[model samples]
Target: MIDNPKIKTIENLLLNKRVRLVQPKNGYRVAIDSVLLAAAVPARTGDKVVDLGCGACAVCACIAKRVNGVELIGVERDPIMADMARQNMSANGFTGRIETNDLTNLPCTWETGQIDHVVANPPYMPANRAYLSPNTKRLTSCVEICASLADWIIVAQRCLRNRGTITLINRADRLNEILSTLNRGFGSIVVFPLFPKAGRDASRVLVQAVRSSRAPMRITSGLLLHEANGHYTSKAEAILRGAPINL
Candidate 1:
């Protein structure tokens, strides 16, 4: 439990209440992107999965709820957020540990080529290009601060085993950057776009690549998140309800 009186928080239900998350009230809160990213990970029973920058462990909770018997680990930079993640995972009856360390400089405890899968919903905006927020937590969560996108990918590559996969969700505009960084250490890339509605451009993309694979990149048809009336599509709603999505 967070004992800081100055820090305000709110409780939210994720994956149809399978995951109960307590997050800071004012800072960056967990959103659907976390759920979507969790759904995209192809983790199986007995596999060890690591989530980089796992704020509140929403992705970990969601993945645990969806896939049984998978070992879950989270890396979070903020101590407060890392505590919240541990609390959330415990409340959900999930077993996992949250390491409060910057993703750019992971602790030596994390052995190389041990993790079966790596999933991340990294900060979307680059620090140099985007205006930062006044709040430190929100600024660090949304905009790249100590770690850039490439830095996150490098960490993922370092921790993941050969043939292990890394899944990420980011802005569609940054697809080129994501691909360029991923190409250096990963292959079998699949770019899955998330469209806001029919006939509209994708606002976000989910990219999955396998470490040391030689398969060619493929772009998927993608999934539409909402209908014309702004309601969630059935697929998106199912995903929010802890359904799995193949990339």
Candidate 2:
């Protein structure tokens, strides 16, 4: 892994944490949704956790701090991000629990039911609608390039064990697509809508589904992220800050 490239960008962790990511200004950068997904991941001691599309390995870093006893593996399609993820894993002294691997066709090395939990913050936009980056490597992994949502979900299904949980964050308008895909494979689902503030419609949603469960879905109350004055609510602050969010 090449050394962590010098960068000037800053990333805010929702709360205090050991792993602080120094985002490279030029490459693929992670966003608040990634932080939310990482914090919301249901992890248990010794759980085998895998992150799909781990840009710069940031989610794994946050997971290292928030979740205990999870042996983390980050799967990236881009070699640059994959290498950067390796370096990031090493830099944060998480080499032992975290590792990076690139499989152009995701779920390449994983066997059925091997993973306990899988988390993905997929490209929000569709391929044709997104603008390609000038950088080819960065282009390949982002939705702005053309990684299909179906491809990502199929890979997630292959890697997760029966009854394993799959968590995802996606654009609010795409909830129907995400739910349809999950229902065909896994049954039990919990969807939480995320709103920018009270009285505003949610623009994003977090989905949690278990493989092969036939239970009814439980939709949680909307998670209001901010108030009218741009202040975080108590519940929103808890999840954003990496505190346990029990819903």
Candidate 3:
């Protein structure tokens, strides 16, 4: 882990406090979307996974802790966030590699059709439509300053082998764009919506697809996070606490 005395941070835990991460205090903090995205990945032993835009390595650490013998590589453009991602990996005792590079312009070392799985929780808000935060980190985390949804899909497909999986979480309103992009190199898509309440409209959705597959798309019943009293349901609690997400 590289030392950065000038960067102010706060420690947070994930996977029911099993993984520790240090993130910029006033910047984009780790969100549940990342954890949920990690859980959506069906990694087996010895699988090679790459996470795009891996802020603070939260998703990497979460998957590593839950899936044994999985090798991970994270791509992040921001130097400070990339440093924090590397530190978080070391702090969590993870063996993944963190590369400080934009996903659209990855290094030559990242070869095509070699990775087993690729996961990402990219920025959901489009720059033209959403309010961009003054804070650079927050703005970048929420808006796509460097890459578009199609760019992320293209890179993930370039790195993943045939039949390899790509999992991601994004705003429900953008599911159409997500599906369209995934169709370019992926198939057999399964979408799982995350509802704030039983009858509420879904605000977020987790989508998983297989590279170059031919199966039909399917949608699950989806996950309702809260009860009427604004408390987490048992299913939500289990998933948030590290239990594997069932598609």
> Candidate 1, residue 35: CA error in Å?
0.3
Q: What are the runs in model 2 whose C-alpha is more than 4 Å off?
A: 1-14, 96-104, 107-109, 132-146
Q: For this target, which candidate reaches the highest lDDT against the unseen true structure?
A: 1
Across residues 11-46, which tens digit of lDDT does each residue of candidate 1 receive? 888888777888889878998899999999999999
For each candidate, what is the lDDT?
0.91, 0.74, 0.89
Q: What's the C-alpha lDDT at position 202 in model 3?
A: 98
Worst 10 residues of 1 by lDDT: 1-10
Q: How does each model score on TM-score?
A: 0.96, 0.87, 0.96
- Scored by Cα lDDT, where does model 3 land? 0.89
lDDT of 1: 0.91
Residue 2, candidate 3: Cα error in Å is: 9.9
TM-score for predicted model 1 compared with the true structure: 0.96
Name the regions of candidate 3 deviating beyond 4 angstroms: 1-3, 107-109
lDDT of 2 by residue, 100-210 (tens): 444344446665679888898887877677687786645665553545676667778888899998889999988988888887888779998899988888899989888
Clashes of each: 0, 2, 0
